[model samples]
Target: MFHTLKQVPHSIAFPASNTVESGAAKEDQAISITYDKSVTLVRINCPRQDGHDWVIEAFTALEKCGMAFDMVSIQPGEVSFTVKSRLVDSVYRSLEKLEVYPDSVTDCVKLSVRGRSGQPLLSSMITMAETLAQCNIPLLRLVESYGLIEVLIATGYISEVRKALAKNFNC
Candidate 1:
């Protein structure tokens, strides 16, 4: 049965039959994935009283050693970052010189998921997390920023994680 409105304020047409599918296609085009393999995650323990100082010192040491790092996370008594797997030895040596022992995970990879402009940050994050969870992927560390989510995970799961995200977001 079809019923007509008694009054119409403004004319609005319902979405086309393919609207939902088209929206998913747009999301697939708007999302992009990038990654870096052969990365190492290093975490250094510092005294709470001097954690900040230790962090600065660690940076300086890395600089002196001519090693570059990223994904640096600093907490009250801990600092973690990533460097090229090739530089793990230098990183460990440099830290040892400062009497800082750091635990590290080698054979890691960094994955970045970028969303198009105006995308909802929180929703995108939640969706990404859910996608990973559904795939049984373990996220070692996660960093979220404007329109971007970076995750560190074991290199072995890179393909699986990427496939899951691509499937979930249609990317």
Candidate 2:
């Protein structure tokens, strides 16, 4: 129902290689997208039989609380969603009323990377994962679809993650 919102561009494109031509450049491009500071992740695990119904109820609750979510993913018996951090309390209370307490609620930031033509370049994702690993930053969750990679990382490490990604992408 909220599809009318204007699409905000989140990806920044960078040259794939270090070579710089004197004039026009020709090379593959990589995109870097970072979402930090106002994001919170909410996860709920429900009985498989009732997972679908619970998901609907959870969305209704979020709507009732005037919360806007950025993404939602559902597994066999788990439902995870991301929403603005400011509404965490309202969302938590709303879910509590339905006996749908979250399995884990944590503050996180999202970073994504993709190729120009939506190609799933495994190397990009690996670079990000390796960078976080090397820095001792915890990766809370990761999701990849249609060549887009999204990672939820500890809020405290968002800056460090961004720096690492920037260096890798040479942005």
Candidate 3:
């Protein structure tokens, strides 16, 4: 499931200044491959009895920690998001203050696959997923915008994932 790309201070994949000219490549072309190597995937499982109020409280606690999160996915019993890997202890402390414990995978990498302008990233997503599958890299999460697809995976497999993507897309 995908939610709005909401970061506290609003950091997005592509800024307004990045524009495509008339002869840019098609959507399948990979413009660039960028990554953040200091991310962690944090998943908090709330008791079904707690309902959705825990979601609000969890966000409040995280905000108090001055955390900027991305790839936020919310479901009935779980809230999954990514934060700086260095902040894992801080996240744990903040949530534990509310008697909530979160499961986290540190040393995660976020890959941003930017495509050509005027093309939906839907197809690129499938290709990227297939590439990852070929490399045996598990995709933790994925989200796409008009010309970008952001994927989360364990940092240990970053090299293999990057190599596979570069081979498949010539990035």
lDDT of 3 by residue, 53-94 (tens): 889999999999887888999987899999887788999999
The collision pairs in model 3 are none
Tens-place lDDT per residue, model 1, 1-171, is 001112212121111222332355222225445677778889887844753877888789889978888888887788888888888888989988888889999988777655445352334556667777898888787878765677889989976875665566533
Model number with the top lDDT: 3
| Candidate 2 local lDDT, 99-141, one digit each (tens) | 8778555666666556767654544555667778888888776
When superposed on Cα atoms, how far off is each prediction in RMSD? 14.4, 6.8, 7.9
Ranking by lDDT: 3, 1, 2
For every model shown, what is its TM-score relative to the native structure? 0.73, 0.64, 0.77
Question: Which scores greater on TM-score, model 2 or model 3?
Answer: 3
The count of backbone overlaps in candidate 3 is: 0
Model 3's alpha-carbon lDDT is 0.73
Each model's C-alpha lDDT? Answer: 0.68, 0.67, 0.73
